[model samples]
Target: MSEDVFAALEESQQQSPESVLERLIETLTAQKNYHRLFDALLMQQKHAMGLEVLQPTTFDNVPDERKKEFEEAYIEAARKVGNLFLDEKMYSDAWLYFQTIQEPERVSEALSKINPRTVPEDKVEGLIQVCAYEGANPEKGFEIMLQSNGICNTITVFDQMNAQLKPESRKKIAQLLVDQLYTDLVQSLQYHVQQKMPIAPPADNLRELIAGRDWMFEGGSYHIDVSHLNSVVRFARLLSEDDPHLAKVIELCEYGSRLDQQFQYPGESPFEDFYPAHLHFFKALVGEENDRNLAIGYFEKKLEMEPDEDDKQMIAYVLIDLLTRLKMNERAIELAETYLSQFEDPNTFSFTSLCRQTNHLDVLQKVARGKGDLVTFAGALLDAQNKPQPQES
Candidate 1:
């Protein structure tokens, strides 16, 4: 068969996952078709392959005649196509071929064959998809994709895995993605820095600081919870290149550090209030704030660069929260008035936090309807915000 004919036939097979699995099985069994099937299957996924079986017994209980027909079509397609090759570098082409195979169930059955084996994901991309979506062994799949040389393919797999993760798992995987990419990304950024791109730190202590544990480093059984958030933030930075939406997330959660203050003064800076993981993340992103102005400047640059709407508001809101804490009530009020037409209700965490900090009643009274979290908590934060200097009060 010509490539075009095989291509057309492959398209037809892809529409039915069950049929594809059966065909693959039949091809695997047949002497003449075996080679051809491997060719096509190998070309189908640059990593791993598996059938996404919705019903295992469907094939088992099929009438012999129907099973025979399905098997024959698959086997025939395999024989006619002859030996084809799938290269890891040629993932997109392989993706199209796999996309043409029909029957996810059939694909899943084929996958059942390989589940127990620790196979390299680069050899079977479809399995990664199945395992990720169909509840197969994802940890193994994640490792292979990360190690693959093909950057684009890795990104594709990452996106697929990211979509299916739970919230807690998302934070974990996002961290994993960041950890995996940070070195390369930092190297890339380092190059940009040498070439005069605006950058804060030269990838020096960053990698070394992150690399401490893989070997002899041990924190002992008395685990420090603060360090965990710091680790997550480091990973978040690495994961951000592909997920720009995090700029908004960072605005909301970036200030969420858990580091315990060491000194009696500086009266618990906002920077130290969240988590050490966040501090590491912020340091990587904005560098050390030698002074308060530098910290505010960092915030300014962030606000200017943020593309997401929610992110923009959060940035302004967090700043307002900071200013209110700093006794810069006038500035906090100014921002609330400016952003009122934009931030709106419901997403008023930042706004309320600001009003609470500033004690500017006129700015806060209009937003009084939300209650509890709105009034009580905000009022408490307001009172705390009103505390006199550490020595004076």
Candidate 2:
């Protein structure tokens, strides 16, 4: 077969380019060499366009009139090769082709179906990259990392995630971590509780399991890794209020709060009482009526008592963001008007944006005038002037 292919290839040099391409395609297709077939198809398109086929060139070099045709050929060839790779479960290779055509969804769907546990060791890293970092199936990728590499490595990966990751993907991964840590803590705590008490405690809820169990923390004993607890509870802040995992996360914070003083590491600013602060924040986010008010009062006190300007600003921003998330925009606007007036950097936290959200351009103008920021003051004046007047009956 090799000799015949070589003979045909040698013979094709004497034939027309079109005939040569046809023979190449037929031969490569017969051998199931789709990768080479992709190159051959691209070569054919380049030949038709009267461009040099020996070297690679971007679509930018293609004439305006021919660009669409060239792109169509590229997309069709990519889809053919990409799907062939996908059908063979060659996900990483498939991603290469599909990504060029901006069709990650096809690869993402295929990746989602894969059981990471069953994947070969040699292939695991490649699949992880395609799934996790490539934005194909981050949740599945995170699961693979957690299952295969264990919690420590998974935490490292989460910590090292760059800003390029979508907030939604980050949230999903965070929720997974929360669920895993919560389950681990519950199981460990249940075992400890069973050793001491004859009656088995509630199996699922962390809060119920740990309730009135002061003896559980005797001699600085902890059910789960305190560091893991701290990391996961912090990650839980990224979760949406509506996420079912928020309740579990809040429960985790409750567990953390009971840890000995040495384990209760102080956090920055408003979360100085790390577990307690986060517990209240998560409670408020969970939208229990009493807890919501308590959480608000908790942060408000932090803002009031904090002497450091920077720390106070951070607390105010946290409170303002929480209020906004809870749809207490009036409260958010009031806090912004009070505490955020001095913060001029929009990139940090946009006082202007909050003003816009509340439709209080007058406040923006006032704040702008106070700061002597002519650009913002003038813009606010123009915006107010352009408002559609209310019609008098």
Candidate 3:
């Protein structure tokens, strides 16, 4: 039947191109062959434009008079074919068309509906690549990877994730890790405590689990994988202060601090003490009254003692960020004015943004004038002018 239609299409093409396209579309649509229909539509558009070949790179050479028409036709065909592929549960094939048309949200939405358990073993990795690494549905992708490939692989992938992944996406993955590790640690602790005592630990909280169980740490014993613990604690920094998992993360830090010194490795400045520093940092982030003061004093001392100018800058930013997070905007502005104002690049920390957020453009103006940065000085003046002024009572 297809051969007969193709034979007639060939004959019709010689007589009339429109007749050939109409016949081809009718036949492919009857057969539910939307993939081929997509190609056929593009072929018809290119034929109309007198182009012998149709490639994305060659689109620039398309006649200016008809470029919009050609692009619109291409987009329409891509959407039609991509939707058909999605309806057929052909996600990999659907991604090709939707991606070409810069419509990842369509593919992402479809991929999100898939249950990880029902995914074929052979197709798991490809789906993971599209959903997680390619930015389609990162949370779902990470979930699928964790459930299918296990925590080790998920952690490796999470660590390898570049800066292009949005902070919210990273935070979601971090929350998953914290939950997973928290569960594992609690189970392990419960079992161990059960072995020694007649009953299990009453509290599921990590801090409560090991409150007086020094014997649990005997001979350098640990409940969870120490490496996983370290990685998740580091990743948990990306989590927001209000995240419920933050409490578990701090508990993990406390557990890490109890480990033998051999397990305690150093980290970058401000976190050089590793788990202990993170415990204090996370505690301070959650507004723990004593830890807040301790964190402030600790970072202040580190900033004062650092000898290297570069290291000092890094430490100063950390202190400033901590101050800002604590809602001590005045102190943050002071630190920014003192340590960061001289630096023009705001990639790491924007002094201008800090000043603006605190409604202290006057401080920015002062810094800009001191540095002889006319652009910023002028910008501050303009922003100050735009701010709403109070009327006389």
Clashes found in each candidate (C-alpha, N, C closer than 3 A): 31, 0, 0
Give TM per candidate: 0.30, 0.87, 0.87
Off by over 4 Å in 2: 12-15, 30-32, 198-202, 341-348, 352-393
Q: What order do candidates take by lDDT, descending?
A: 2, 3, 1
Compose the digit string of candidate 1's lDDT tens values, residues 1-393: 346544545775778744554455555445344444544443333112243233332345445656665454444443233212122223223333343453223333334455423565455665555455444335434544555433345456555556455444455456545554444444543554455535434444233322322321122211123233234343353343235534433432322321124311121223323443243333333333453455556566666777776667766765665455445578668876665423435434455555544655545544453433465446655665676656865
- TM-score (C-alpha) between model 1 and the true structure: 0.30
- Of 1 and 3, the candidate ranking higher by TM-score: 3
- Across 1-393, the per-residue lDDT of candidate 2 in tens digits comes to 668887887789788888888899888888878898898888888988998776433676688998898889999999998998898888888999998889899988888888867978887888788888877788888888988888988988888873556788889889889888988888898888788886864567787888877989889989888888888888888888888998888788788888898998888788889999998898898767898999999999989889998888889998998888898988888888887876656545788878877788998999889889999999999998998889999
Q: What is the lDDT of residue 259 in candidate 1?
A: 16
Winner by lDDT between candidate 3 and candidate 1: 3
- Stretches of candidate 3 above 4 Å error? 1-5, 11-16, 26-35, 45-62, 342-347, 388-393
What's model 1's overall lDDT?
A: 0.45
Q: Cα lDDT for residue 323, model 3?
A: 80
The 10-residue segment with the lowest total lDDT in model 3: 52-61
lDDT of each: 0.45, 0.85, 0.84
- Cα lDDT, model 3, residue 168: 86
